[model samples]
Target: MGFRAMVCHRFSKLVLLSAAFISLVVNAAPWPDGAKIAVTLTFDLDAETIWWNDADTMTGNPGSLSYGTYGPKVAVPKILALLEKHDVRATFFIPSWVAEQYPDAVRSIAAAGHEIGAHGVRHVSPLQLTPEQEAATFSESVRVLDRIAGKRPVGYRAPSWAVSNATLKLAARAGFLYSSNMMDADDPYIHNDPPGLVELPVSWVLDDAPYFWFDEDSWNKTIHSAASVKAIWQEEFEAAYHGSGYLNLTMHPQIIGRPARLLMLDEFIGWMKRHEGVWLTTGSAVAVYVRGQQGRSP
Candidate 1:
């Protein structure tokens, strides 16, 4: 080959390599403040509302319903203490009924400087409600949360992760800054349809219900050991740490606050802290950061 032709080919290769590097720099480092990974430990504090709203309920039996009461009665304080020990601020999405029924629990969560987002009115899915009912429930959630927490919640995660087509638009109309129901992406993105509402995606893999939720009435007897769940979550966290740099772990106070499971969660948080460049924050903070990054109002 002629020297000039060979030189031209080498120049083109160099340009392509430079472009690839620039793309990596822009796309790979999405987390803020040079953090390698962003983590939000979110809890859906459904409490007794789930028992009453879900069809799987054994609500006829007081013993069956006591399981839900265990959440706010015993689990929440323990969960709060655990989070306090780690000095990690997390998010709790509570149904309005839970907040009202256990105002003190909600107050304690807020006093600890955690974010409280809307779950629904009575843990009912938006899909189960008509548009008017959904709107009313959403508004009631905002009202109760604001009343109890002393701050209006800016985030929403639909009960049971059952979001309808109107849920996002309704949340947007109600002035929510973000929704955490969708599982489409690993990273947060602004919804084009709502035109500025941020979506912090979630998945069942990262949620505790599939692994730990046991409902006798529903005949769901599967409950893995805490060690197994910890290993699964650790693997998932590592992958997120290396890939998209975002990990949102969803849990319930009743399920994860059990002694062994809570111990596992404490150990997991410690393990995560051992890694450098990890930001453990709340859902609201994540939404604000991602929105600010994308040139939108937080």
Candidate 2:
């Protein structure tokens, strides 16, 4: 072959080989074949109304009254029934205040094979607390949840999605395996604080509470009906279903317990059942899976 033709041929062959190698590496990843995505359902069981503390009392903060009005009476039961009906497991991020009020509910959740996680002592924003206060909150929350569930909570999720570096450090120091407080990535990642904690990043866009509270009218307009929410969830699931990526779905029992919104959750669970090869699990399970993969890797 002529010199120019030979050079071009070699370059094309190299490009083709590189493409094949890239394809092989991606295809050989640990996720099961035809399984592109896994989802972990995490509920923030704030249970605000159950507390007698001034800051958490129903009369003190009517907007935060999840426990007294809806949680114990309607939401928790509905959520449990829905999960049981679908045969799916989930994680409940319980504040120390809530665990103290509803020890029976915490035990029931543990018995039902779901994961329990710490969600601070009160539903106060982490950014508002000093480092010492944050550490105490973490310690107390862990202690309370462990007492109720008979197992130490391995994961933490900040109340109101408000977190700080200090909060993360405290969580790590408290012996948590993971925190869902960081929104830096779409995938699960190991965060290296001085004490080291993995951050299974959760998407706020994927959560339902913000949608309902901040943009209630817009949310109603967008989701329109139950089918709309179901369609959006399915689309997101399909997009995430091709890699060993993590999907975190966040919900508040009170917010999603309404008859209309519950229907949407039911539909989404139905769709999840129709699909095969997806690992529907709790946040702790996802954290464990990621930790296992880290251990296996060089």
TM-score for all models, in order of appearance? 0.87, 0.81
Tens-digit lDDT track of model 1 for 1-298? 1111000110111111132333111222245667788899999998777666454452545676777888999999999999999999999999988899899999999999999999998787789889998999888989989999999999999999899979999999999999998887776666766777888889999999998988677775788999999999999999988776778888999889899999999999999999998999999998887666553212
Lowest summed lDDT across 10 adjacent residues in model 1 is found at 1-10
Candidate 1 global CA lDDT score: 0.82
User: Which parts of model 2 are misplaced by more than 4 Å?
Assistant: 1-29, 32-35, 49-68, 194-196, 214-224, 295-298
Q: Which pairs of residues have clashing backbones in candidate 2?
A: 36-241, 36-242, 36-243, 37-241
Across 213-236, the per-residue lDDT of candidate 2 in tens digits comes to 433324443334556666776777
What local lDDT does model 2 show for residue 43? 84
- Using TM-score as the measure, the top candidate is 1
Candidate 1 residue pairs in backbone clash: none
